[model samples]
Target: MDEQIITNELLKRYLQGKCTVAEQQLIADFLDDPNNLILLHQIMAEQTNSLWDSSADVPQHDRGQITVWQRRLHERMEEEQLIPSDKTKPNLRKRGIIPIRQRIQWYAAAILLFVGLGALLWLWIPQGAKPSEQLVHQKNRITPGSDRAILKLADGSTISLSDAAKGSIADQGGVKVQKTAEGEIVYAAVDKRASTQSYNSINTPNGGQYRVTLPDGSRAWLNAASSLTYPVEFEKKERRVKMTGEVYFEIAKITNENKERVPFFVETDKQVIQVLGTTFNVNAYADEPYDCTTLLEGSVRLVAAHSGKSELLKPGQQALVGNNMLLSEADIQQNLAWINGYFIFRREDLGGILRKIARWYDVTVECPPELSTMKFTGKVSRSQSLSAVTEMIASINKVKLEIKERRIIVKK
Candidate 1:
């Protein structure tokens, strides 16, 4: 394939999952060269088709080999000057194709411009320049929804939602919701729970998340590797739900049988929290070791499941429910930032940040000795480009972090 056919912009967009079908097809065609196609065939031959299709077997078999081949093909295409993709799509009527000579001239001028900039940077800039988003550094700390979750139900049938089909499997009350490809589940609660009907539960793995709604017009947003169990309907004076992971709740008030302040309650692995009317976030990732219940608007009380140790939290206060104790008056915003699509850190140490990153991004963190003590305080939008995050951390002196696709490695 000609390098001219594969534009840098197209490759970047293709990797980012933002390419249109047409643009995607162009990149796929470029990648699926005869040689590359033959390479996959060769890999298949090296292992049985069954093994290739399995998650546990494929990585152990040929994932690294596959990457090596892809890189080889990418390098070959770059060297051959294949297709050139449009970086910007201006109106077709406004911009016309330039002659080959003009393009070559433009490329040469661009090279000189970069060279001049580098010369100035070498003198004025410090010894180590921070990486740019354009560099695609291995040390970016952006997390994505990792496909890892185990669904646990009251009947004891565990369904792993991490890689399940993205569609409606069954009816829950009156809600006809679907599980999206990105793993953000959707449902509209349907009312049909009888008096004796049992409840069901879904658990996300350490690196998983999902969403659900109650039949009483309440919404639940689950965060990584958490589990939630609820009845098909409210069916009582007050509604109640049991959770293990983290969840953001939007409760719809229900009337009491005696009208004596009947309210909805959230019971976690450690605490029984009451919420009548309000929004709140609960984090009970077992792996996190420290469970949190944060109130955004309404008030909630966190009590020990075994000892009955209780603490009432204000709107901005958070309750940290640990295995042995409960502490109130924590930072509510920082604990619940995940629900709002932001990873906000305030002087959090490397180990502490790693726990949060591991849950949201579904990747393991390897922090070397020198960088383990380092702390960071900044706002990294969860929607940030992965490359931009990598560059941002590279801005801090002394510590270094590298992002190798999904896995992140910390360095001195």
Candidate 2:
């Protein structure tokens, strides 16, 4: 069978369950050739675009059929091991002719091609039921988290950043604290010579996040379930801040009275990061096994609180503070994905991923012992609804995820 003859129309017919047996065999043969996978990808993209363009024209009753087709195709592909159930195995097929088992594996690839179309359709069509609906019909749907936090002033007053109007929220000692239109808290020194120096803290609860501009003009982004405490006005000699959970910092350069460079220090439970003028991220959640500091720009020195051990990190390096300080090349994108509105995983365990989901979505996760150690690699937007994110995880990892109230239960 000529691969060119397998046109979009033919694939659409196959998806509609109108393909002849010979046509099905032709698809299987086309998939057998690894080179044809590129063609399949192109066809899927084209089909997805076509469906999106004509989605409004699709009949209400037919939309349900589309959803069913997508679910079935996804299930069939998973059953055939086409999606690579075990991510650790390597593909051993050559470019030339293959054996019967290899050909059968290629048939799974064909199903995956269609499954991709179905998944895209499910995302585009609003009428299509969400993946969570298949598991259990719930009274309420869980939405995604957003920008929200609480600011604690030096006077023991609390301001809700989420509900506070966009203006000057408070005055801290000699500093003017204003909330910008973009929802960032900015601190400006109105009286640098004022005698009093007070402390203020910003805290993000579960399912919340916030950004702040400090007195020294440095900016920090706090991830969900994080907190940062700093002086309302930086002292003349050095700037220091204490933080928990995860936060990204871009330190501004400043000089003291004698023109000497002022240093900045970030304190976590496990370590203290000394910065001259640099951008870095600190993940120090107490629940996690280790505290990690990733440097994005400039240089920073990480000193362990207990062992007094220290490591200097360059722009692309990371220092992991645990039993011993381990320094390695960093995955900058993965480290900064939260601030950039993404959850990027690289062969991370399911339990670790769920912990992140729990913090961002403010939900409890019940992971069976057997599934906790399973590794997965994928990227999902932080803005997606809880059900959407879980659906992607469940579909790709071939697991069943049930949402009961605010809890996610993972099953084999």
Alpha-carbon TM-score of each model against the true structure: 0.56, 0.71
By summed lDDT, which 10 consecutive residues of candidate 1 come out lowest? 116-125
* lDDT (Cα) of model 1: 0.56
Per-residue lDDT tens digits of candidate 1, residues 143-259? Answer: 466445555543566566656688875554454545676675555554554332557777776556677666567888877767788865555667788987678898876676676
Pairs of residues at least 3 apart in sequence or in different chains that clash in candidate 2: none
lDDT of 2 by residue, 283-312 (tens): 999989999999989999889988999888
Error of 1 at 33 (Å): 49
Stretches off by above 4 angstroms in model 1 are: 1-143, 146-169, 172-197, 205-207, 235-238, 323-332, 385-387, 404-406
